[model samples]
Target: EYRLTNPPKPPATVEVMDGENRKHTLQVQVLGAEETWHTPSLLLASVGSSGGKVVFSQIRTLDPTEDVKQYGSTLNRNKICDIAFYQKVHLEVDPGQYESEETKFQALQKSDKARLEILQDLLSSHLGLSVAEKQGPLPAYTPGYFLGRHELKLDFLSALQPRLKADNILKLNLLSLQFCGKGVEPSKPTASLMPVFLHACPQRFSTVEYFENLHSEHIGRLLIFSEVMTSSMEGLDGAVLHHGLAVVACQQISGAGRSGNAWLSPEGCGMFSLQLHIRSDSYLGHHVPFLQHVVSLAVVLAICSQAGHEDVDLHLKWPNDIYVGDCIKVGGLVVKTIVDNTMTVCNIGVGMNLDNNVPTTCINALLRELKLAPLSLEKFLALVFTKLEKLLVTLEKGSSGVDQVRQLYYKYWLHSNCEVTVIGPQGSKQEVTILGIDDFGFLQVLAKDGCAFSVHPDGNSFDMLRGLIAPKVK
Candidate 1:
């Protein structure tokens, strides 16, 4: 090994000459195993011999750590023996070839298979669902199946169903199993059937055909959409079909379509229904509104059924507003009723910002303070619907349905404790401290005089006051 402690002495200066008779001087310093080589304008001299080369020899007997020491020894030996003097000329080479098409294809195939396997695993584990081979031909309408432990229902369908065909089956389509019961209340189990259709293909389909298929049913037949399926149909006179409820939510895959609208019956007695129109890029904006309406109606019906309250006093507020909280604006509810001598259609709409990040004129600024990521529209909708179904079940049993929903809503209140400015009609304004929402979806505010006032949705003015600095207390 090259020892750093002791080294050899220096050598005298040397002269070198090139083929062109060019002359140069060189210096060599040797400190035992530590040798320093210096060339001061040294010319290249052939000297009828090879230039120089350095080679490394491995020490077979030494351990891994000791091998590093051996390397130094080899380097020292080469220096003292002038082994670098026997090197050859240099050469240049080109770059390597690119990856072949077949190789890339195989890699992609492997990656796709891996992803599919992961999906299958997740479905089996969390969703408790299974997949089987297709029994028959295309457009197959498989009976609904129950999800394990969760009691959720799902239906399988080929791309050939009327709705799927009308919508065009550019991908795999699955029908959701929904429940339909007597009247607009989803209390009792009617009949378990598949009504709503879900497309899992790579291509998008038409929304008009989807809604038309949902509205069409044979006489005395009940329609159940995905996740909203019922279990029984006894005592159902098919009149509910005409005067019942319907919710239609559509998201555009392409083309121009970016707005959403919903309608409700005049009172709580008529048919209720919901309708949505989503353009390709604007689905994100309208998704929550559509889902909130559907779920809110479901929850209301569920509550009425359980409480056995034949006289339900409920009315939908426009632009996604719900009525509760001491007559203030606690939440928003919307309903659409289509009634004719022959048929009655009811649709319900509900919308709550839940956890929005964007700032709006009426919405509080607390939403901007939350650092949560934008929620997935599909996943959030599914979860909200599922929870609403459970809450409805509880309410139908004569429990406090409104209280339950209120509690949940309060848990997600962003402006529960804040000072706000309310703009009234004719340029009237008042400052108030929020004391939380009440039972009827209203904004309860404590004025400067310590008195509480309820703010309604349709009043002359209702805007949130913000960006104001508080005065110091003397």
Candidate 2:
């Protein structure tokens, strides 16, 4: 059986040629089919340009062979996936079956790999020391605590309330580092120690320098790392830097995506994870799933807040994907939460192609096209935090705050009033119109026959290309 993630529109006309060279034309509207089918059969295909003609040839004879079970299994394997294109493009091959084109493609691949290496080098150089040297004992240069003057750290300790002050926030930072160390690969012992470290930070910093009205404790504590297995795993268990610790990385070797998928993390990608602590009885606690929505809104609003970026057409995909200019994803969010008796520690991981171009387009690439200055990573992050800080306040205000967020989400989302086909676990299908998100962040849709229901983001995968909502196979 063929499952078309992007199926052709209705009124698809098919032309068939008989063995006697006779031809017949038929118009077909494919609605449904068997969920699974197995058979060795000949397949015919065609390629063409958009708004152009495509023709398929007739098969003179039919033959059945043993099923290629290995090929099917390989296709079903769970692995990292990347989006490279929004629409199909046909390639014109030269006489030698594009031998020259193949050679050029190989050269381009090498060039991309080399570019990524250079970016990695730049990230290391940003710290003014090599990874190997930093790992060595008594390294020539080691960042001081909080990368600040000792007196400033003392001042921050005194300013905190007695309870948090006694807890010792600096000690918590050390515990986070130790937690990360245990999770690193045994082969790369230095990876745990050298790359990740505390940088310039203060418990109470002035956001007036960047943006205003943001009163956040942990969000501004920047933890810069050269590389890591994944930012999501850092400071996860144990004493996490919870007021809102920002863990930024140059690159993630194995970044995370929704449903255990892999996120491609190379240099030029703005990869980070924010760890925040909230009360279980708070307004946010009841809507834990909406954290991704909050982050998603913060990203687009952050970018648009800049002077020249006010007109940048950034949008949020359902749940937590960020898209720029027609289905080209530029960023995404993955959230994880651990709940205690009365508090919830949430980790929000974000990966954005701010300057990277591999897999798909980046934000800077779009800026360059618009003749606008590219955004600096530092300022962009500050804006996101500012927007997030403000949005979080709304969540803290109860249902009214959630309604405000939902209203703003609808303003920037791509699926408002969108028509999609929802496929059920039993191979059932229904056409639904997306209304908005519910209180719990699940997609609220109105199906035909005047039925209304919500689709849980975790249970269904939304394929915007073909407007499909299918069960998420674990």
lDDT (0 to 1) per candidate: 0.32, 0.61
Tens digits of lDDT, candidate 2, 137-251:
2212111123223454345445533434221322332222321222443122232332232333433233234333234544644333333343434534344443565665555
Instruction: Give me the runs in candidate 2 sitting further than 4 Å from their true place.
Output: 1-218, 222-224, 227-232, 237-239
lDDT of each residue in 1-474, candidate 1, tens digit only: 332222223245456774224665544322112124221111221222333311111111222234445565554443433322211211111111213566755655556544455444434543346634232322322222111111111221221233333322212122223322223222222232243322221122222333332321221012222222221111121222221223212211111101322321111111112232222232212222333433454433332232333233322232234432223332355433334443333334343333332221111222123322332223233333444545434433333654565555554344566787665444355777877544334556788998998654333233333322122112
Candidate of highest TM-score: 2
Q: lDDT of candidate 1?
A: 0.32
Number of the top candidate by lDDT?
A: 2
Worst 10 residues of 1 by lDDT: 249-258
Clash count per candidate: 64, 1
Error of 1 at 471 (Å): 27
